[model samples]
Target: MKKIKITILFLALLQTFSAVAQSSKIKNLENQREQIKKEIIEINNLLSSNKKEKNLTFRDLEILAAKINIKERLIKINNDQINLLNADIKSNEIKSEELKLENENVRKDYASMIFNSYKSRLKESRIMFLLSSSTFLEAFKRSQYFSQFSDDRKKYSNKILKNLTSLDSINKILKDKIVNKEDLIKSNNAEKRDLSNERNNKNNALSSLKRKENAYKRQINQKQRQADLLDKEIDKLIKEAIRLSNENKKSSTFSLTPEAKALAESFTKNKGNLPWPVERGAIIQKFGLQPHPVVRTTKIKSNGIVIATTKDANVRSVFEGVVLSILKFKGSNLTVLIKHGNYISAYKNLSKVFVEKGDNIDALQIIGEAYTNINDNKTTLQFSIFNNTTPLDPYLWIAK
Candidate 1:
């Protein structure tokens, strides 16, 4: 009986641990779902409602594509949640069965114990039991036996109550989980419907883009040329800054002062924890090379990530730094570079600038307004990070 009780306790602990683990995973997936949903809303806000599919431009197509992609991911998260709930339900059902079996065995043992105790009670009164003992030690042993029997009965009674309570709790959990699973299924179905509509919209936009394939190709080429020019200029400026900093030094990197070295070390330690350039936005384009969403055969190269935000959103510094330079050229609105020791962060496509060269800036200080294209009515900020002259992916540096 003791061994059986120990076994049941072990199983109960194991089940508790499993439930906690499963709950943690479900919570993590829920967090991811909420973040994706928020991003979809931000992207939708950036999209121009006035533009019909027939008038959709390349940037419009990209926004729609991004929204659709995120919606699919939300649906996938819902599916994962449903799968986990199903597993939980199954586990609970199995555990409930085991508890029921254990309870029955315990009740039987308890019933037998009560019946035997009743027979013994009828056979002798407590006074008669003690008087009938052959000696003092025998009488003491009999008293102990009676006390132990009573304690055992009480222990078994408590065990029965605990088992019943456990069964009730498991049943409640099962019922709640079933309801949750049903709700998730309904939610997934609704998301699927929305996803279907988004796909249709994207397809219509793609059709419009395909109709003017050659014209759009020229437009893409022109945009790429501008982007390439801006990248080259930024690279040249970074190199010049490095050369001036290392004028008398033998090393190729910046010669930092004690204070600057400490700041650099702090920045390095926060590689993945830096704030976003804009307070509210979603990344529409990532760094590096990738194929165009509409034009699969054509490749697009990006030196930095592009964040689509509301019109005239404030662009802020991700970390404390000094204003390195402000740049402007045709097709590329305005670019501001902030230097943090050997690392530099660049903010491009701004309609205004609030800081100047040699100006000391604090983390999250408003630098300028993100450029809003009047023609497309879309606002976007181009943000880049570089370790001296080498470009780093801003996505890796920014906080998720």
Candidate 2:
């Protein structure tokens, strides 16, 4: 019986630690869910702002798709939380039943102990037991037996109380977990309904876009031409900067000073942890060749990701660098190129420029405001990173 009690205690301790770990996991999931919820709200605001147009455009459809994606993620997190709660509830239920059975056995033992003590009292008192002893040795032994019997009665009483308290606590935890699970299930179901409606809206928009496929194709081609121009301009400027850095020698890269080299090393080491150019935004266009969101047949290649943000959101520098050049192109906003040794980060599509050429800039320093198109009511930041002249995906470098 003592071994059984010890085993139960060990199991209880293990369960306590396991509960703490499980609680941590649930907390992490809740944090992620909250962040995703905020993103959904941002996307909804973007959609609301674009509602000024009489009909939905490809941009509207893109925002809707993003919303649906985030909504699904939120629901998945909710399901995960619910699953954890279910496991906890099941474990608690098993423990409660075990406690109930143990308590029953203890109650039975206490009853038997009380009945035996009563019968002993009826036969002879403890004082009489000592007086009736035939010798001093026997009296001492009888006294010890009476003391042990009293201790045993107290131990049984305390055990019963402890078991009852533990059972009550477990029952309370089970009730709370069940209620939490039900709430999560209700939330998940509501999100699913919203997700279904968004999908329908996206499908309707896609159908409308298909009705004007040829026009969209032309627009895609025109956009590609503009991108090509921007790419060439960026490359030319980088080459020119390299030429100036290596004036006495012929090289295709910048001749880095010790300070510049250290900066570049730090920048390379901080990959995937770089800050965003815009404070609050979502990547609408990803890097590299992907089928156009609207016209799948028309492939669009991007050297960097395009972030859609609030109107006139300020664009910041991702790292410390010297502004290499301030450039502008026809039918496009201004571009600022900052050189971190041989690595170059470019922020384009600015309505207003803050820093000038040769100016030193720090990370998160505001450089310009993102241009907001009045026609579509969309504001986007075009961000790119390059190693010498080779284009690297901005999405890979920026924090998720």
Candidate 3:
């Protein structure tokens, strides 16, 4: 009876642990799904709206491709979640069977013990055994044995009660799990529907855009030239800033100042942990080479990053650095660049600039407010990182 009780207890603990693990996994998957849904909505809005001015140009196709790649990853995650649920359901079913078996064994043991106790009491068997002892020592020993037997019987009774309680709990859990499993199935079916719709939209959009291949190619070339020109101007400004910074360091060598050096080292060490330039925004465009989002056949390349945010959002520095340049480009908006050692970060599409060239700024310091498009009221900041003349993806450096 003791061994049976121990087994039941162990099974109960195992089932509890399993349930908690499954619950945690489900929660994590739900969070990931929400984030993916948000990104997909943003993409859909971009496609449907007349925000083309703030939209990804042919040169920004690489960013759009990365966004699509993220969607693919989300789909794979959903599949994995469904597989996990299936496995959990199977495991729970096996555990429920084991619990039922243990409960039956407990009931049988309890009934047998109660019957044996009743039979012994009716026959006066325990008292007779003690009375028939040949000596005082023998009688005492017999009494002790009987006392132990009664204690054992009581312990068995308690165990039976506990087993019943555990059985009730386990049964409830099983019922609840069935409901949860059904909900998971429904969620997966809904996700599949959304996935299908998104895929169909992507296909239709690609087909429609391909009809203007020549015009799309021309637009791509023009956008590429604009990006190249911006790249050149940014590179030149960064070099000049670096030269000036070095000169200042040389002039201040007598003071043995190490603050700038330490800050620079700190910035380098946190390569992939840098904060976003804007307080709250999403990456509407990514870095690297990829096919255009709208002009399907044409590939768009980007030298930097494009982050979309709420209207009138403030742009801030990811790290402490000196203000390199604040330029008004094409009479549109302001662009602020900051230099940290050999690396330079640019923040563009600002309506107002707070820091001037040569001004020192700290990490997360608001440098300027981003400009909002008059039509859709969507604010976007064009961010870029450069090591000398080579452009690097700001996304890789920023914290997710």
The superposed Cα distance between candidate 3 and the true structure at residue 19, in angstroms, equals 7.1
Candidate 2: segments with Cα more than 4 A from true spot: 1-14, 131-144, 214-276, 283-305, 318-348, 357-363, 383-400
Question: Model 1, 1-400: lDDT tens per residue?
Answer: 9999999999979978988999999998888888888888788776745354345677887787778778888999999999999999998999899999999999999999999988988998988999999999999999999899989999999999999999999999899999999998998999999999988988887886676888888888898999999999998888888878888555557878888888889999999889999988887777899887667688999988988887789999999999999999778899999999989999999999999999999999999999988877788899999988888999898875
Which is the winner by lDDT between candidate 2 and candidate 3?
A: 2
- lDDT (Cα, 0-100) at 265 in candidate 3: 70
1-400, model 2: which lDDT tens digit per residue? 9999999999989989998999999898988788788778778888887887797777787678778778888999999999999998998999999999999999999999999999999999889989999999999999999899899999999999999999999999899989989999999999999999998988888887787768878877997899889889889999988888888578888899999999999999989889989999877777999987656677999999888899989999999999999999876789999998889999989999999999999999999999987767788888999999999999789875
Give each model's clash number.
Answer: 0, 0, 1
- Arranged by lDDT, best first: 2, 1, 3
Sorted on TM-score, best first, the list reads: 1, 2, 3
Instruction: Note the residue pairs that clash in candidate 2.
Output: none
Instruction: Report the C-alpha lDDT of model 3 over 252-324, residue by residue, as the tens digit.
Output: 2112137766766777798888988887666766688876655556676777777766668889999998887
Q: State the C-alpha lDDT per candidate.
A: 0.88, 0.89, 0.71
Best by lDDT: 2
Name the lDDT of candidate 2. 0.89
Quality of model 1 by C-alpha lDDT: 0.88
| TM-score of structure candidate 1 | 0.85
Q: Report the C-alpha displacement of residue 294, candidate 2, in angstroms.
A: 4.5
- Taking all chains together, the TM-score of candidate 3 against the true structure is 0.67
